[model samples]
Target: MNKWLTIVLCIGLPLAVGGVSAYVTVQNIQNWYPGLAKPFFNPPNTVFGPVWTALYILMGVSFYLLLREPSSEKKKQAILLFFIQLVLNFWWSILFFRFHWIGIAFIDIVLLWLFIILMIRQFYRVSGKAANLQWPYLAWVSFANVLNAAIWYLNH
Candidate 1:
């Protein structure tokens, strides 16, 4: 595959996932979300879109860097971990916003966090830069876990 095309696809994948998740998220922000009990630390709604966009870009870059590494068993494991976390990331939006399953969302986010950590560890083994790129993603998910927990506690 062409290197540039590979880069585009690497970046595009996470952005696409984020786009779909955002679609589900946006649909609820107006009607269903505002009614929820939120923590004092819950960020303004406007913060999410840009933050998520940035994070997805970072994730894509990370994936790209990982892919650039020589083929190896560790790289395959890292790639698998990345996809697992990405799937978890997508489902969190659906669980939280679409289904109004706050508790389930919390569980999903926790699992997402775990997957991210594992992904980062595996990414580090393959490419340090790739793992480094995941830091913001890990940070955001950490905050999200707190936020999800707080929201669940407040509402339930």
Candidate 2:
């Protein structure tokens, strides 16, 4: 496949998944989220959209770079872990926003953070840039774990 196509696929898939995740988030942000007690550290709702957008794009590019590696069992495992964390990424929003399961979402975020860290390690062996790309994501999710814990504690 052409580089352009690869780039498009790399970026497009994550954005598309993020768009779907946004569908679950937008409604709750307007309705349910406003009522919840956010941590003092929580930023205004406006921050999340842009931050998540950039992170998702970075995730896509990182995944693309990883995928470009020679096919190997390690690559396959890394890819699986990548998708697993991505699923957890979307599921966290749904669990917190849509279903209103704050405690469970907190747990989910912790697991997600761990999975991201593991993926970073695995990606490092494959592509240094790809591994580096996940750093912001890991940092954000680390902060998010604290936020998630605080919110759950305050609310429940």
Candidate 3:
């Protein structure tokens, strides 16, 4: 595949998936029971869009950096982990927002956090730049995990 195309896919795919998640979350937030009772620390609804967009872009850049590596089993594993975590990210939003399942969303975010750690380790092995790119994404997810847990605990 062409390099630019690969770059675009690395970035575009995650953005597209995250965009869908954001749209769904927005649509269902008012209808979701627990989300309405979120803690004061819960950012205003406006904060979510920009934060998620930046994180998704960071995620895409991380994947793009990984793709620059020469083909290898390690790189392949790293790429796989990247996609896995991305899928988990989207699932968490769907569970929390659309299905109104805060508990399950918490579980999903925890697993996503673990997977991100794995992906970070793998990215480090393949490309330090890629690993670095994931830092903000990991940090944001870490915060989200805490928020999810809090939401589940408070609303349960």
Candidate 4:
């Protein structure tokens, strides 16, 4: 594959995954169980879309930077971790929205948060720029984890 295409794929594929996850999350929010109570700090529903869109784009850029690196065993491991986190990323939305399992979603996001940290560390080893690009994503996921925990706590 062409190098540019590989970069595009690295970015675009994750963006596509994030898009699907966002769609499912929105749909689920609209259909959320009526009795469940949200926390006081829960932002209005309007905030999620734009916030996630930016995060997903940042995530793609981070991955694209990593792809620009010369191939190596470490690069390969980083790429593997990248995909693993992406899969976990999508599953968080599914667990929270589709399955309506708040506790499970909390568990999933905690795991996702750890994977994101590992990915960032690995990305840093390959390309400092790539790892730096991931900081915003890490911050967002950290906030999301707190939100997820609050949701689980309040709803239960």
| Alpha carbon deviation, residue 51, candidate 4 (Å) | 1.5
Flag regions of model 1 displaced more than 4 Å: none
Worst ten-residue run, lDDT, model 3? 29-38
CA lDDT of each prediction against the hidden true structure = 0.94, 0.90, 0.86, 0.85
Question: What is the alpha-carbon lDDT of model 2 when measured against the actual structure?
Answer: 0.90
Kindly list the per-residue Cα lDDT of model 2 for residues 1-156, writing each as its tens digit: 998799889888878888887897778879998898887789998999899999999999999999899998888888999988988988998898889999999989999999999999999888899999999999999999999999898898
Per-residue lDDT for 1-156 in model 1, tens only? 999999899999999998988886787978999999999999999999899999999999999999999999999999999999999999999999999999999999999999999999999999999999999999999999999999999999
> Model 1: clashing residue pairs?
none
Tens-digit lDDT string for candidate 4 (83-153): 99999999998998889998999999999999999999999889999889888888988988998888788
Ordered from best to worst lDDT, the candidate numbers read: 1, 2, 3, 4
The true-versus-predicted C-alpha distance at residue 102 of model 3, in Å, is 0.4
- Between candidates 3 and 4, the one scoring higher on lDDT is 3
Residue 151 error for model 4, in Å? 1.1
RMSD of each: 0.7, 0.9, 1.6, 1.7
Q: What is the lDDT of residue 99 in candidate 3?
A: 87
Question: In model 4, which regions exceed 4 Å deviation?
Answer: 1-4, 33-35
Top candidate on lDDT is 1
Identify the leading candidate in terms of TM-score.
Answer: 1
Off by over 4 Å in 3: 33-35
What lDDT is reached at residue 52 by model 4?
77
The model with the greater lDDT, 1 or 4, is 1
RMSD of 3: 1.6
